[model samples]
Target: MSKLCLVTGANGHLGNTLVRALLAEGYRVRAGVRDTSDTEPFAGLDCQRVYVELLDEAALDRALDGVEVLFQVAAAFRHWSADPEADIITPNVQGTRLVLQAAARAGVERVVYVSSVAAVGHDGSALDETSWNEEVENPYYRSKILSERVAWEAAQALGLWMVSVLPSAMVGPNASRLTDTMGFLESIRQRQVPLAPDFHFNFVDVRDVAQGLIRAAQSGRAGQRYILANERSSSFADLLRAINAVSPGYRQPARAPRWLLMCVAWLQEAQAGLGGRPARLTRSQVRLFQGVRQEYDTGKARRELGFQPRPSDAVLREAFAYLWRRADQ
Candidate 1:
């Protein structure tokens, strides 16, 4: 039988790219989405799509029926939820359990779990697969770490084959409704971005991430986690310069002291707690900005998976073009 792969979050940024790459690899596609009606991207392809919420067991079965590989990418992404732990725990942690259990029961050949680098711990030095990020101060990171553990546990208990791909701050252009990198770009464009953080981050194009998922499904060893990142690390300032290069009139942000920002973060968190409207700084947002100098080594993925990432400038050019066109509309 031909490989029938089910990609959850099929309409999402990376998920859409994964589906296309799977088709190119000659696998029959089954999109696991919240609504089958939204499969516009796959309209011309002879693919199966099922409306399935991650936590809905009945819906999961309908989506997973006869699937050989499962690509679990759907997860709650926002760091601050009105309910914090509750927002992340059930959908991300519990939903993953549901997918893995169903895959085990259905005898799926392998599962590729799409995890984020946010879940990976940042040691004081360069972090790799072996390093565990200890200071997971937010619900999103907490949920991802817990969810990854559930996946590994399920792999051991059910003898299921699984691999986790941790992608860094993704940089690419696509049809995703999610803000992701675009949110950062918009802040820079509108000159609303704060003074550059001291932190550094690796970025990969969505295409590279999609191809990495395909490679993981084919050649990845079970029960292993791989860090997928581009070689160069870009600071928030570098990102701004890239934007200014493309979008005329973009001004560099004034430098704000980190300690001052921390104070703003505290007040923002307090306001959110009081059911006030959104603020510029919050605990989650500040924690996000804390790791300005951290770097990641993608040597493992490059050596093992033959993963080669495009240059940061190329990624910036593509993202800027996409964003500009959209902003014009």
Candidate 2:
């Protein structure tokens, strides 16, 4: 009998791809999702489906029963929410704590926690697994930083064999819905973005991240963190050029001035506060990425896990092609 694995948030972009990856490796998979009704992502996939709410301890325990490995990939990934603490922080920090506790109770052998680059601090230099982001203005970033710490704490206290994988802006195929990264690309392709912001983003393929997670589960040292990101960061303009090369007729917007961008972001936030939809651009996002270089050192993953990531241009092109196909359909 193959080892049983349970993947939380199996309907998410990275989670679904990881489920497919695990299935391809011949492991028995149990996909934990919020709603079984939204089965489009799992269509035709041979796997057990279970409803998983991170905050629900009984549900998580039921899902983890007899599982050899647990992949805790669910998190409230929102930059702007009407209520940041309740909507973003509680679900992420408290939810992670509950899931790990339940996994401990269920006697799961190993766990792979999905963290983000947001947890890693950048100080205009290339960051590695050792760096930590102590201060962040964005609620999403704060949640990740705190949640990762909680995961580590749980692992130590419960003597659980757990490893954390930090991935950068994940881009590639197998996305059932438009993620923030994919949506950003679509906005560029449809010419919705009038001016490209002066920001740099570290891009990584979601498939590679999935592979990294598996590798971590197989050989990663317990309590260690692995960063799944490109060696160098790509500017917003670089992303635009990659999209233009793959899909023609979309002009690259010029870089917007920092002051002007901040002013626009402030106005958008004010509008969102006045019973409008969440702002597409927020001050926290602007402050987080404006003129900042998002670079990382992935040598640890390559050397330890034998992880290899695709080029940013290739990732972007494939992502745009996938988006184009989805739009046409």
Q: Would you list the C-alpha lDDT of every candidate in the order shown?
A: 0.77, 0.89
Query: Which residue runs of candidate 2 sit more than 4 Å off their true CA positions?
Result: none
Give the CA lDDT, 0 to 100, for residue 42 in model 2: 90
Q: List the residue pairs that clash in candidate 1.
A: 121-133, 198-292, 199-292, 199-293, 200-292
Candidate 1: deviation at residue 181, Å? 3.3
TM-score of 2: 0.98
The per-residue C-alpha lDDT of model 1 at residue 103 equals: 87
Measured with C-alpha atoms, the lDDT of residue 269 in candidate 1 is 71
Per-prediction backbone clash count: 5, 0
Candidate 2 displacement at residue 315 in angstroms: 1.0
Candidate 1 lDDT tens digits, 217-318: 888878888888765677776776677678766655666666867887788777877885544455665666566554677888887888888887777767
